[model samples]
Target: MLTYNLSNIGSDSLYEHLYKCIKKDIVLRKIKPGERLPSKRTFAKNLGISVITVENAYSLLMSEGFIYSLPKKGFYVADLNDVQPTKQVHQETVVLTSGHTHYLADFSSNQTESEIFPFTTWIKTMKEVLKDNQKELMINSPCGGILELRKNIATFLKEFRDMDVKPEQIIIGAGTEYLYSLIIQLLGNDIKYGLENPGYPKTAQIYKSMNVHFEYVNMDSYGIDPQELERKDIDVIHISPSHQFPTGIVMPISRRYELLGWANKVKNHYIIEDDYDSELRLGGKPLPTLQSIDVSDKVIYMNTFTKTLSSTIRMSYMVLPESLANEYYKRLSFYSCTVSNFEQYTLSKFIENGHFERHINRLRNYYQKKQEIILNAFQSSVLKNKVEIYNESAGVHFLMKIKSKKEEKEIINNAYSKGIKLNPLSKYYSNSIENNNIYVMNYSSLNSNKIEEIVEKLKQCI
Candidate 1:
């Protein structure tokens, strides 16, 4: 018979406590391999607990391969001789990583602020999903994603971005990076890709890893120059028209049409509209998406929840052109959906319940206030006369032109040594360029309270 002091179960339920206790004993060799466990009823009576508790514990143990059972016989501990003995780890000794340096201010990361996250709302929606969507959760999502999520997203795009897209056109993926690979596969590798110069580096990194032919397309004032794309003879161009990264250039309506015209000129031409971080547009009405204006079926629209929700969510999606959508199913239908059914269903409920929009409204207000506070801090800080801020109208980050004689690299390295992480604007450029003293001020996850301290530290570095 298994012996456990059930009186001190603490926060755990009757079955959970029993399960952990039994598992620990089995792991420690107190319950030897092939040793029979008392029947559920006998164990329950001995422990003064319900038989259901013992049964559940036994079932859990069996499911985890810690124990086995024979029909019409009894439960027996499974052989764990090959498994190493569990070692107790001290809390203080268990560091997640070695030599991990903590930064006072990480201006390079565009991670969402944890304080603004609607944890209570998200948790409630998730719980509701677990209770109401047990069946749907078990069902395998289609290669694109669950219909529920896609449908909600479709409706959202229509109302928010004025894009008329069918749910069938949306293909959900783990992240924008994952979807980029899918795009390369969908549109053969032979074609040349025109990437925005001084844009997000991750896109270029993805293309390089895939060994695809690509060139850096220089950007004019409007955005990625269509003339540059034509000059490069590029078949595919990746762009962030709504709000260009680092530069924060929102492509004008004229530019959007010009790019679409260029795409229409070539039979194989396609524009990957990476509309990342458009939701957090700080001021004025949200600009229309390129997909909403696209008529030539040349746009492959992509967006992610990482901006509005959390970065760890790993949920992103793309809207394929009608023809491309058909082709995707014909060619890539065998690929199972990358996101889990539970997440898909939970997001669907989040959107359907109006929590997403409300959260967005609240977030926008919070970020607007936060951005003001940080900008004001910089303006009033000791570095007030030494810094020039630009492109603070939209997005979570802006371009900061630091008035310094030191090179960008030197300034960045010195700042890092002082516990400040500064990402230089030149790092996004593919070709080598002289130091401009410009840095990308990503304040999404910045601690506003530490702004004064950071400015003082940065003063020492610059």
Candidate 2:
């Protein structure tokens, strides 16, 4: 009789312990293909467990394709060659836990609160647009964008961001990622690029996939160091000046000028300024974009509706410098397709009719109140000393530096056990850095009640 020890497993049921042991043996290829498994009666007798427990383990293994049973003979190790590994199919599905209608707290992503979305007004406008512009809505828009929408965007930027742009200069695409990809293609592969260190990983991943040569520029509270640019013979710099991701630090005016001056010194170089989440200023007026200051036509401004409106919209526009706009159009005309005509028409009307501004103003006020609620919750909680909040005056998300002596993995694992999800700061850094204690928390998605719940749970977890 082959005897298996069950004493090693603590607190786990007999079936679970057996399942884990068998699963590991199969994965490590200890059990060769066609190897016969012990009969449930024999296995249970040898292990001193009930037959039902062994049967359950075998049933699970068979369901997962780790083992197979012949009609009369018995169960055996599955043929490794015949059994293909399961693959996760990617789909456009947002996974939220149901039944639990409200979460005590969640800090997953900065999404508009439920009450902030103008669903009624949006539906009314959408219906009106569909009724009035039926013909135009069915047809494909121009590659650049609908002329009216482009004009609205141009005007909005000029008034709000102080950008000097024409309708022809703007190109609308799916989102910031798509626009970045298009920009990469327009610039071609020969140029060297500079990306911020401890910056958005997606930017680096995208550029790296295109086989572009890029260097990392270390960032400080003031923003990306201009002195770092002197070390690199780079042709383009990708920057997020308004609100830096993960860190949430705003790039100061002095560094903005210095960066522009550096770009001027580097002949044939350009700056890709991603002005993401610049409109949600909590206290001061919105800063003028780098594109607004670019007299040499060296800055390519990119903005998206993902932060302001719903991320599902996937609407983004880029303001190309006059020097590259014509060439970009010629290149994009051949390959790029415009967004939906109906959406373009609706958005154009939204801006023209002043609904966009009204929506923004409402969201700003809603988020400001939400920010205060979060701040208050943290201040009153036991986690006050354990977490140091950064850049709380602006943006939808803020950084919290974990002061506990425990490892980051330990903290994350503990949080996970309590059904809380957290984004670790270490994931943002590509190069070595000193501050590994930071974590990005988004309060925009939760209500005051939810925020309190999350903070309370966090206190207990810590």
Candidate 3:
């Protein structure tokens, strides 16, 4: 039987805390493999917790594959022999009771402006989908997602990204995270991957969670330095050539060709191009995707509508090369599409009827106005001389380099003390480098009335 002291239940929910404690024990190998856990009622009686609490904890553990149950028998521990054991047992104890409402203005987030979401347009389209395609709602999405949606996406990519990909090469998934895992499975496990150093840390976290061996490729003025790729013996590389996160540097055409040459010369090497926020480019014409110029078919293109559309929509897709697409069906055909038939059909109609394109155009104009408002607010403020904005013409966020006498942590702390949330640029780097005072000032959440106030408060902190 398992044992734990339940007398001092702090702020966390009783069941969740209990679940974490048991999960920690399981990971630390305190309980032996295949050990039968005590019955929920017995455990509840022993620990002075509700039986329902115990049941919920057990259910969560079972869901996460930490334990298994037999119909006639009790629950038993799962084998963690393959799981790379960690020394630290106790996880972060402080769980926030309140949500993100604690912050006054959270500029750290890159979420789309919810105020501009096309709710009425989407609702009308969804109603139409329900009225017309009643059969689709009851069935599962196609193995590669609804064929109509895939066809519309292919057409959109041809016009929006200038990529000539067939519908068969595209696979729709729930989100970027899901697609990342599928890619890992599609490619063999014996692979060494590389992610950009000052890139989205979620990518690295996902790779680490899956026990993937990945390295951080350092960046330069343009993008991921080609020399860094040559230096490391890597099998796969994930990058955002069009509008890199936080940095907003579009890889020039020359650097892109250099990458293609590198992939072509090397055998069994591929590039994962994450063009996540490409549709939101403000002023200039949309840049050509690297997948467009790849005659050798070594680039795996990925994009997500979650950023452009509502975050809750959770629709992302990937475009694999012809060979990889064939290999996927040969091996991964058993997997059903992560998205549902109803939502997929609605999205198909939305794209087919020219609504998605119009929505994107409206967002472009909306974000451009917001961008100008925030930049002008900063320039007019007293801190204007101290803050240098970079790559403001492109994405929803711009890099704000602060010329301050204080260190990065000190500046961030001061800002937080004033109820301001700051995303320091140094937090993104996994490698040891020079201390650069940069902050990612996101304007998507910027309120025109509060822009001056936020800038003023930041001025006081700096």
- Overall lDDT per candidate, in order of appearance: 0.87, 0.79, 0.84
Q: TM-scores across all candidates?
A: 0.78, 0.80, 0.80
Q: Write the per-residue lDDT of candidate 2 for residues 1-462, one digit (tens) a residue.
A: 445666556645556678879888888888788889999888877776656567767877887778999998999998767856568676542333332322344566655655677788778879989899998877777788888899999999988888879998999988777788888888877888888877888888888888988888878778887777777777898998898877788888888999899889866688999887888878798677888988888999998887888766879999998868899877668754557887888888888888888888887888888888888888888888888888877778888888887766556544543446677777788865554667888777766766776777677556
Ranking by lDDT: 1, 3, 2
Question: lDDT per residue, candidate 3, 101-216, as tens digits?
Answer: 33556778656556788989999999999999998788777678988999999999998888899999999999999999989999975889999878898999899999999999
lDDT of 3 at 151: 97
Off by over 4 Å in 1: 1-101
List clash counts for every candidate, in order: 0, 0, 0
Q: Over 4 Å off in model 2, which ranges?
A: 1-22, 25-106, 432-435
Error of 2 at 12 (Å): 19
Pitting candidate 1 against candidate 3, the one with the higher TM-score is 3
Model 3 misplaced regions, further than 4 Å:
1-91, 94-100
Clashing residue pairs for model 3: none
Residue 2 shift from truth in candidate 3, angstroms: 42
